[model samples]
Target: MSSGIMKRRPLKAADDKVHDFLTTGIGRVKALIRGSVKGFAKEHRPRSKNGRTAKAIFAEAQSPTDEDGNEIMIQVKKLSKIYGRRPEEALALLREGKDKGEVQSMTSNNVGLYDVSFDIRKGEMFVLMGLSGSGKSTLERCMNRLIEPTSGQVFIDGLDFTSLNDEDLRIARREKMSMVFQNFGLLPHRNVKDNVAYGLEIQGIPESERLERAVASIELVGLAGYGDRMPSDLSGGMKQRVGLARALATDPDILFMDEAFSALDPLIRGDMQDELIRIQSELGKTVIFVTHDLDEALKLGDRIALMKDGRIVQIGTAEEILQNPADEYVDRFVKEVDRSKILTANLFMRKPKNILYETQGPRTALRMMDNCDRDDMLVIDGEKRLIGMARSDGILRAMNAGDRDISGIVSDVPSVRPDTPMSEVVQIMVTTDFPIPVADDDGILLGMISPSAAAETLRNGGGE
Candidate 1:
């Protein structure tokens, strides 16, 4: 009887606390608290007619586009989530120049997110990164409507997700997106095949079709022969692979992975990260990955959103973030990161100033190299495609021999792609000659990476 009373006592105290806050106005208190609970519960409940109608949240603003002009897949605009009985008061305080800590201290309200806005491009691997309490997970949940936002909008491929009716949202989740959680959420009693096919089963897919899709997904994740094994029989990494296969089985356009590989051992985690990169490259799926590890984010993200105190402090590629940190906080956050791995050849490469045409005479090549004060000049063909290097000695020899064109004097030189890592570039520079040519797939000379430029970039921890 006493234990029962003890458990009920906490509930009674909670009611009393609500009653005390009711002095502010019973209707307002009830509405705010009830709405918060209902909104959260509505995420998992069946279709409800009470869900809000869609609105044109981005009608006044332009939708963001990628560098390749790819359409935006996910756009979050001024999204916020405040958890408290007096959320309105907390929100008011937040808007009046108060930080999350200050607002929480004043009103005892936890501000999970505040004014978060960003656009994720289609087929981009976008990362949300921060410390434990920085609200990265909260932001991800808000984007997917797992946790209802206090205010603002989320647009999925131009469709407003926030205003979606329960049935529409559920259907959208089923068809347009899927999530991979940190902890493997496999059903304990189900075999690997059944677990992978769970999403298809939910959609009432034919049993044979779902099983076929599940087997393909399993094979894709490198778990081909483990279909009959239960979740309990799999190792941790294998379990994670099963989880990934399950998410991929549905073939969702957008994959929301929240700290998905944080649980595995270091070696296994690295393998999973590599596998994810390969898979993403092959599938070209838009991934919104959440992580606290800066290295992991730097390695995987096409662009990263760094959050602090429930707000995005910065958003950029790894090189951009490392080279040009937005603020002191961001600077500190990336201070210890290995720049060699993050910096690329394209970032530090210089324009090819002493370029010689392959059709030009040896004298012309020599003159150009002299003008640029360079020992060697990069020779290009008629189409501006890189041919090779023309050293001063080679040009001089060719001129002495009365050669009509510098093409014969041009020698094959080691070259690297623009996206090559700085570490590999440095190694090439060490083993080969200075002023390595940076070229594209078609051998078009994009730029040059000089030894001095590489040295300075490494020393200063940035690029030109």
Candidate 2:
């Protein structure tokens, strides 16, 4: 009877504590809302879907061509571009090696591209990247039936251009696709306006319409005043701009760029890459951009098709290919990309859950929180979407909110998703003045994954 009495007393005492916690915690949260909402609304009124007020916040990049406007899709079918002495014998030896489980050999000279295949979806920035002599350039040229392949099919906009007659191929190039070379290939005799207008000229466009299109293209390339200047009078970067303008002037559905910025200095190269991305965002054409630079590929490629020995070793989104490379060669190509620039918010959005912030008094919430080891306590409304975050440590601050220095006790923190690439997590963790909320597909709270946690996740490929 005595032991039963003692147990009953402790249980009764604990019940009273929990009861106080609930009532007081709710009061404190109500107080926080009362204090912050008005001030927050006054200072930084919440943005709407298109950056307006009184609604949600959602925005997307600008694209000039709608889904129907750009339609020249490219698909490479078992592409092989081999050029060297005794190609047939070399191929035979390679086949023999494969049969003998020795797929690589020392005495091989036919290195451009060997039996590669992949597709460039319409209105996608399909980047082909590899080291020098990886046949990236050759493979790109072969797509538009520019370079004659040794023994593979080149399909453009669903037509097998490799098997097409010269007249048909010429018509296709003129009407459907345009090429940009490493050298500007501008006519020295003509000014920038004429150089840009040359493609339309070849296609029998009237000079009046061609010049108008040329001027627009020159402005598009950011070479407005230089339309009257000759190619020799321009710098290397400017000359490349001239080349890009020429390609754009043709108004072809597909654009093939071959090492177009490799000749410029590093700063100029970066600028050109930015310009290309901005233009690509605006034009939304099916771009097959060839380059040996991995960083450049990451910056521009919607889907990076990493090529090796003339074959597409891997094909995926920049994140997919970088995070889960198909093999050793592809892995090495994307090992050093600075990932923060490409991280998107949707990647961190987690599945929705039934978590709600209990509006409790500071002391009560702090005492309750002290009994656990959770990184954070999510505060949600009736909808269960993220409203705010309450840190485990923040409970203590909220409790001591009376202290003048603890004015900013409750603040905003970010959260992330389970499958989010760690790169985005790191950016939010480093840049934002808060912790990240890790969630699932439906905006459900899945606990917090910190920057350190994210880095470790990447080191182990989201395992362990």
Candidate 3:
């Protein structure tokens, strides 16, 4: 299997079956029981000596699964939305490759979305980001069927949400989806507790049960004592919390947030972002968040779908977008981003070519340096734990000194964890002549990040 990271592929039927089995508790239990029975029947099972499971091997081979192993919570295919009296005609013009503005001008209709398609995976904070009129919010609205899409299909867990009738769609909205909007959509007359309980109330939940759920949700959003206060009394951030609590009170599987944090002050917005992360970590709900601020999108999104002029231009993780922009628009979007804070050692590091084990003699080390045409080599123990650095001169000196092993000539080298951000990595790189080593918590040598790689990554961010 190649060591390089793999791009995600569309799910196959077999992959979907495996995903369903793994995601469902009953299916997982059945599989575990079956494995145990087979093990008992054979009295033993063969284990890989390297300690990797079959699934892990397949994943390393980049077979049909995403690296995060998240299930698809929502899937949108060829989604396009047009506005105006005759949207169907406008959609036909769009399908003919007419420019959005041209189609709208020629048909006297407005384009709200332009063939936007993507997936929101389970437990992932997927972000929709774009300037106003870019169709980010429109796309988000279409996901929950708040705005009917003129053309395209929306599948929620393999069920076509766009195909559902109004009654069934209403039921699905109540039981499966919850939305938080940019404006704190709170009822002005109602107190915070009542506002939070409104969704449950709409669902016809009993008063006591609804209030209990609402209170728990209010507390979850850090508005425990502020529940009794009216929206008028609470600050903007607090009111937004009420909105969050209201949406969460229903405990729906999918969350749709359209600019939910854009109204708050910067400090409060940062706090809310962190709070959302904490809550999402605990709850593991599938979240589709909409934002216009690039910083906010980078900070909050697990994967961002950047929209431009009613079309999705790019979709990727922050690092992926920074390191490999899809086009000039994407290039401009990431131009001002601080690569040091977003790029990690894992992304910047390259595989080590020549390694010297501690058990090898100085002569062996020198020979490798000549063959690999390198001045220095990383020294590791038998278990691949990086211990030190060995220079060609040092190896020769050790050999001349009659040392049996190169361990005597080994020197301490700078190292970092795989996830260490490039912000700190640059400081370490400038002080060391050697390529920085990337290791895990256990000190196992994983890869090397040369100074040139760091420079290249920064340059890719449109920096020096």
lDDT of candidate 3 at residue 128, scale 0 to 100: 90
Question: What's the count of clashing pairs in each model shown?
Answer: 0, 30, 0
- Stretches of candidate 3 off by over 4 Å are 1-69, 336-464
TM-score of each: 0.61, 0.55, 0.59
Per-residue alpha-carbon lDDT of candidate 2 for residues 1-464, written as tens digits (9 for 90 to 100)? 99999989999999999999988999799969967764554333222223331111111212233255654367677776656665566556655644112323444545456667766678788888887777788888777767788777866656566886665566567656788888867889999999999888766666667889999999999999898888999999999999999999988888999988888899999999999999999998888888888878888898887877656678888789878999987766565443443443344344433233545555555554556545455565444555566665766766665533222344555666665666657666667644477755776665655455555546655331
**Regions of model 1 farther than 4 Å from truth:** 1-68, 336-464
TM-score of 3: 0.59
- Which of the predicted structures, 1 or 2, would earn the higher TM-score when compared with the native? 1
| Error in Å for residue 122 of model 3 | 1.1
Score residue 422 of candidate 1 by CA lDDT. 79
| Better-scoring candidate (lDDT), 1 or 3 | 1
For 355-378, candidate 1 gives per-residue lDDT tens digits of: 889999987777777787888778
**Deviating ranges (above 4 Å) for candidate 2:** 1-72, 97-109, 336-464
lDDT of each: 0.87, 0.70, 0.84
Q: Which ten residues in a row have the lowest lDDT in candidate 2?
A: 53-62
